[model samples]
Target chain A: MAAAQDTGGEAAAGKWYTAAKATYTTLIDTGHAISSAYQLVNVPSGVWIDERGRIVRPSETAAPKNQELKIGGKTINTQGDAYVAALRDWVAKGESSEFVMSDAEYRRRVKERSPREREADACFKLAVALHDRGREDEARQWWLRAQTLSPDNWNYHRQDWSFTSEAGKKWMDKFQKTTTDYYPKLELKEKP
Target chain B: MVNRRLLLFGGATALTGAPQARATVLYGDREVELTTSRVEKGDLWIPFGDLPGINEFSIKPQGACRADICIPLPKELKRKGWLNLSGFARKVKQAVVNDGALWSFGEIPTLRGGFPESRLAPDFAVKDRKGDTVRLTDFRGRKILLLTWASW
Candidate 1:
């Protein structure tokens, strides 16, 4: 999905949309469905289902060797070996094999998000609404809450950065590398 | 050779031999109605949802139809003989052409997050990259996602 900054993107999308017949679908943030199901550890994950509504492949759909990240002068994180093997196996065994998961196993393996994650989703939504309404500062507060609720989620961080200035982008880049610095950890009293 | 092998190994299954079933359909902001008998040639037709334009910042569904490929539907919908056209279509752009092969929704926008969200959030009305108005609810039973990015 298009992230809004002071600069406009709709023009670019419109021009591209008019010239091409192929449509593109983009997810803003994968809230809980993906994290719970397929146990997605990263972005751009895939789950393939057969014609029978069965997951022929469990999760980790991207080709292991396909990952390449070299932006500017820095390198992004890479997938591990386990991630690669699972994808390779799932690709070859689409339904009808031992690798094929049963309904119960699939459901169980796809971890359900806790109430915290659900709340994070709501926070992100509220942030989006506020940002769209031009209350960017207010949106950032909600986004900050979302980040606290789900530290692993990149959507909240990224959306906030989209509105930031060049300096802000640099800060975000550093934040991605180390999240604890700016958004500090909160010590809590656990319930017995 | 490796790619082909990988496709066979990685969850790619052929649907050519399977019995044709009804496909999900959606119109602008409404679910297209259908009955078992009304389905033709394994295809379910829906009305126009909205003309392609750059109004909103994000597309609804992230993986439905992207650049010439129709993301395969989950088999559960096939078994029930009906898919949530409204829910599914809300995620992508899948307008049908005369040839029967599904058309991919074109590029609209991109979000600026270093990573995507954990779940696909409900579609909302927003301005596109070019500052036009678009709504996800307009295309029920279609796949879509809102894609936006920062200029900073």
Candidate 2:
């Protein structure tokens, strides 16, 4: 969304689409009757509530849907067609579409988290709490815990890293697997 | 390892000898300041970003949790005793900045809900598709139900 906004494509694409999507998803899918995302420390997260207002979904991926982004040929970026197709599918099929998932499925998705992955969630949560309470040192410890648990999740790393300056980024570089690991490693080194 | 000790309370502050419990803290943008205490006794939940502002406002004083400390929200932190997030942020020196574009928080919500709890419903102020300021808390005392649909 920010990328879209940066290129002055917000009008063609929609400016608040990202914020709206975030809010819409939250109210429709969480234990809170409304938005409480300030506490969200991870992605693909959900809360289940029974018809009786009990939380049928806890912190888990309620919707087990995903998209495989592949780019081929001359385009420098992925096309929006898949995104648009997904939108239409969501509106046209509602929950029946393979795109739309059920609470049961979502819960199962969350349960799929391995001990290390679940521990990563806990670490992320602890880091957020510590960061919020001004315990930078303690928060860093938990964040390292999360990174050790799952090294691929970018949100945890990016959000935390954004706070520091260039100097700080350099300091964090030591812990991270370098920029190549983050982006698809384009460098295919010759046999040494 | 920090002993994996449970923080005393879920969203409340710890009282020295309380068993390790999850706690909540409102960190300042800079690490120089913190409102640390033991974790409060509740799920360290952050509301979704779109629900009526009242929802997040209500939780302002409800008690938020961190790893092992929970800091009670000050009455002044509330707008008429409800959650005033911007005010809370300001109290901690994290001045709220709109930047004429997006209103972003530098931090993520603490997870006090047991493992497998995702799908955050946080309260935030952002421009709509038309660039109008939308405050989720504005829709209070209304009998409306929310449904979420996404493209993953």
Candidate 3:
């Protein structure tokens, strides 16, 4: 098993990595590069790769258990223990793993981005370049632009929110605006 | 046109004394001095922490993004916290070259080919807790579960 952090510096990532105590390969991606590569827009996403280097499963929310949490008085869906159980099944069963998605299903699930998403990506890159130069104001401009381009990408908003003190208020406002459909329902086929 | 060229050429020389000019980056007529960390495969690598502007587009899931624009990059180009300038330039269709001390990027290209489709996961290298380099290929023969999560 391999784990990578999305945002935050090494210090922040280290704090959790040290606590996990997992014997797997733990990595810190300060730049969020893994998020981009794996098409993960949020945290706790997972990809399953078989022994032949083929991606049996694409990025999806992977939770070990179901937990009920109230945020802003709203109940957020965190049900995915089935995914965890499926993972265990895959580890033991290989190709015959019931959790292994078919190639056609994988292709269908991996949605393609629109042209606007591509443009937002470019703007975000430019924004990062400017921000690194200690040009916060300029960076904010691009950040705003990026938000406008990819409104659904919570990471972009959350990462920027981390820089400001009003992150909680801002996130609450955003969260309130989201509908109940915000979290995609987990779809797992029953074991045959 | 002449004034722009002068701005480009003059800025290059005037920046010689700036400490950040240790690694010069030229993008079109705008040349900026950036403190670069390392050079790999002849391309300059910019640390993500040092370049916050990249956050606008350096998302892994959506590819490099900027102001509502995103271009899927070959998964092979990503290396931990650093973005390969050459690989990025190629994905965005920009020309980038390293001349020993400086890195120059030409005009941004209009045409872009999205990331290539492949059944195999792109190989990348990252550092472990012990600071030892770990490559994806190291687990070539093993079934690996690559998971991404964060404390926040």
Candidate 4:
């Protein structure tokens, strides 16, 4: 399944959905509620669900195939191939899949919301609500609070920054200097 | 022109008593433009009797309660014979993000922890291109690679 964390509904997100030629269901999240519900802080995030509708894997940075970039004399590879291979293996093996995280591991990886983080989600929802009503000045203030409360969430930054003139520049600056790793290194393990 | 004419354009005031407030209230994840409210000493007050229609926090003998959850309204909140919704929210530990006029209330204090222990994904509904409501639970009994992307 595919979902857009875009707040503009069809006008902003529809073209991408069309261009992707997605065979799966593509949803438009105007309120960003889906991400909030999953406690996801960034896009290109994925969650794996099993036949019983239980989360086998929690939300994490997901890049399909491979992403190899040469920058500043360093090759940055986001092991998307390994993730995809693990996913395929899960499809083949179901519960017995070595790709599936054990209960202990799952608990370790799953984001348990902090009180402040929970408040941040609420603030985010309110910001969207204010923005929808054309009260953008108020919306910006609330969004900033949300960002401050949970600085790791790039979705909050991107959503708010899109309204500014230097969106791409702002994004690059933040991405370069922000304390959090661009993509947190996944330690997907196999049962030994 | 007509100097004596009282021009009320939406919420704006031509003849000043005090500028009419254009307050947008976000309660229980729902947003609505408050139809009736007042400002006192820079604090906005919604009438005690009008709470139900405004944001579903009705006035009860026990205090302001929504279903089982109730916050005892302090006497200060009852100043000028009106309910201080923001005051009540603050007392209850529910966040209220504001910018003078727009007051957006956060989650119910009891509902702010996180996802359930079952690890089942929280279901949500959104419209597809076909304008039909699509729910996450609809795709149950199958493996799902739920991915989120954005145009920006």
Using lDDT as the measure, which candidate wins?
4
lDDT of 2: 0.36
Lowest lDDT block of 10, candidate 4 chain A: A69-78
The TM-score measured for candidate 4 stands at: 0.75
Docking level of model 4 = acceptable
DockQ of 2: 0.06
Provide the lowest-lDDT 10-residue window in model 1 chain B: B106-115
The residue pairs in collision within model 4 are none
Q: Could you say which candidate leads in TM-score?
A: 4
Candidate 1's C-alpha runs over 4 A off are: A1-42, A52-65, A70-94, A97-108, A166-192, B1-152
In order, the Cα lDDT scores of the candidates are 0.38, 0.36, 0.63, 0.75
Model 3 preserves the real interface contacts to a fraction of 0.54
Evaluated on CA atoms against the true complex, candidate 1 attains a DockQ of: 0.07
Model 3: TM-score for chain B: 0.50
Instruction: Point out the worst 10-residue segment of candidate 1 chain A by lDDT.
Output: A183-192
* Tens digits of lDDT, candidate 2, B1-152: 44333342322322222222222232221111112212112212222222123123224235533444354677543322224444544443332322111122323223224323443233334344455544445544321123222221
Residue B37, candidate 4: C-alpha displacement in angstroms: 6.0
How do the predictions measure up, each by TM-score? Answer: 0.38, 0.34, 0.65, 0.75
Scored by DockQ, the top model is 4
RMSD of every candidate to native, in Å, equals: 20.8, 15.5, 10.8, 7.0
Of 1 and 3, the candidate ranking higher by lDDT: 3
**Judged by TM-score relative to the true structure, which candidate is superior, 1 or 4?**
4
* Overall local distance difference test of candidate 4: 0.75
